[model samples]
Target: MNTIHTHFRLSYKIYDEAFALSQAAQCHLYLSLSQKAIRFAVVDTARNKFVVLEDYELITVFTPLQVAEQLRLIAQENALLQVQNWKLVRVAVSNQQFTLVPETLYDPVHQFDYLRLHADLNPLQHEVYTYRHSGLEAINIFAVESGVRLALQGVFENQPLQLVHQTSALIRSILHVVPRNNLRSMYAFVERSYLTLLVVGPAGLEFCNVFHYTSPEDFIYYILFVMEEQKMNPEQETITLWGDITHDSSLFNILQKYVRQIKLGKKPEDVEYSYKFHDMFDHRYFELYSLHLCE
Candidate 1:
């Protein structure tokens, strides 16, 4: 399905036989992002142009006609290619429900919540960077789009906190700079963005919540409440959370539990070439990386 992942970039796998891709698509273990499994898709490496948001598909809540309509609308803004094939699969997250996100309004922070994550690193070149979250006073929203960034401002424990994205990269092949000292150089390649809330008072920055909740119901309710408290409509909010599949996080299950149409973050690309379906989503990461149902 077309996933609007919160904590991931583009990932791909190669396919050998077309049938292999088909088989992979049918595997019951497709819902990799659950408390039960970590859904992962491999890219068709042979066609190596992965851009994280090139193309996407919906498996659980969409019908063939719906997919067609979605593609048609997307075509309204830009030319699009057709999926190679299509499949009927069900990803049932136990104790989970789903909801429909509004089609037009966009709350950038909620939309890119995942971008506000633990440090994202690029190892090939050994890059690393971290994003800190704090509520920005509505007055300072403009600072967010400015180019002067090294660290970012956020609300921590109800106070101001700052995170740096580094101004530049400095790598030295000779002299004293080694791989370990390539902080500036490595971070140069890391993609950077952050989510901040606007809560400014005469006093400085302050917004931290170290202790929230632990149970499934409490979690979902909390998240929903947070959204509502921020005056964000649950109907308009699209909550797509992605995390390491290994942890067995009940977070996804809880989220799916509350909403009417929760979107999972799995892709047909993860399947082996033989398992992948022909009419599945476009394998280009760039096209599907940010496919949001946000209206």
Candidate 2:
């Protein structure tokens, strides 16, 4: 169905003016898709700020075709076509499967073989995308269903858009905020149906993986298991969390019992947000805001 869990407009005046001057102004559009919702933002690159941000949550499970129809409807509702000549159009997808490999051994020609070791591959039906982690000397290989990729392409037909796995955005965003000096720390980005856990140590990125869970118990199990696997002490190591979770969320409540140093993640300090966004939690829409930093 067409159910929207929540939607917000941060600066209508700026958005209207930006669209009206689309030909002269430099703008960037960012879209993020998760299993349960689609979120987008429009940024005025010249002003170095966000003009509009919105999200639509789905109540019914959507197939690729249905998701495409919904994406088109959302674009129409937001008058996305009114804005032209985007400085950049970046889309991040979180519903697909991904794996990490060292950059030294990465081979673009054999990408499918590398992914097949960790996930099933339908060579004819899935499209593989790779993102290089320059700092960590690793490359992230991910797959998105060709149908979904085509649907996304149709949403911005004829427009130049950079498609990337959501994990890349997550990694970029976390690195932007996480202190380099913190010898041991973990970051978790909780979405509707999945959570991504990233572990960092003095050496560098220690571990990173995504887990799907249906309940708070399942969520904490994965967190605790990761801590155990990494030899991290919950009593001392901090776990900074972002995305759809809150202090009062069941996931948070359960996590507190096992991890003493849990903290809420903050938005990237490098970007400026409008005062109109004051009502919303700072940690929310982190990946959306971080899209501006995506090269």
Candidate 3:
């Protein structure tokens, strides 16, 4: 199947050329893969800013082989001839089978068994990966099909790259920007077909889950349900949103009806961005941009 590729050049000059030649350049390549699409970014760590960003949508869900081919195509098209010295390369997968476990209760020896109990995946067929939250004393455990991991690894076999599961990246992004004093606040990272709801309270991360919705009603149902379950009053609690949603979108409009303090999330305050990024919606690429901040 042919991949539909869209490239957006924010800078007037080709940043890759300068990135390739500059010995002082601290460049990192980041990728986020989902069932339906792939998003990639190149960040100049020396400047603490993004230089190039692109999004590619597959015509249909991709098989492992197809994804590998696309990755190879991306590497070639981007002209990344010298990836050996890259500051870092990271990839995050957007799969839903993930669970968070308290740090004290987590054991590496039984990691697979613990995850299998909560997520329905064959232990033999999937590879388990864990990420620890910096601020909270909890661990995020998730799995990806072994084939998918191998395919992604094979693409960068010659280079040093790290693979991160989506749950970790999502949680990391929220932790980086979510206000610490906000005793009652909910964050919804809205995507095209799914939304990740995170509830934070005085104790810590109170609730975290991903819900798939086909309509506006379904979307609001999950949001309101989380609020109700978490004892968060919509009239007083704030709902901060990020990802592919806009103020004029139906999803946002429906959410406005029930939530009084609805606001769009901004990029992490620690990172710097070029003037070119101002043209795009700040909330649209939270995950992709947050990859730079992920440890």
Cα deviation in Å at residue 114, candidate 3?
1.4
Q: Predicted candidate 2: what Cα RMSD to the true structure?
A: 3.6
Candidate 3 structure quality by residue, lDDT tens digits, 1-295:
9554533222322244444435423788788877656777788887787776667665545454455555555656555533556677888877777888889998988888888877888767778888887578888888877777776676667667777767677678777776678476888888778789988777667889888889999999999998889887888888998888887889989999999998888887787766666777778778888787788
Give the candidate order by descending lDDT. 2, 3, 1
Candidate that scores best on lDDT: 2
- Among residues 3 or more apart in sequence or in different chains, the pairs in candidate 3 whose N, CA or C atoms overlap within 3 Å are none
For model 2, what is the alpha-carbon lDDT of residue 277? 63
Query: Can you write out model 2's per-residue Cα lDDT over 1-295, one digit (the tens) per residue?
Result: 9553323222322234444434424778888876577788787777677767777775564454455555666666566644546667888888547888999999899998899898877888788998887887888898877877887676667678788788888887777677678488999988976898999776667888889899999999999999999898888888999899988889999999999987788878777666666667777888898787777
Residue 14 error, candidate 2, Å: 10
Per-residue lDDT of model 1, residues 63-105, tens digit only: 2223323333433332211222212211111111111122233
Per-model lDDT: 0.26, 0.77, 0.75
TM-score of 3: 0.87
In Å, residue 227's CA in model 1 sits off its true spot by: 0.9
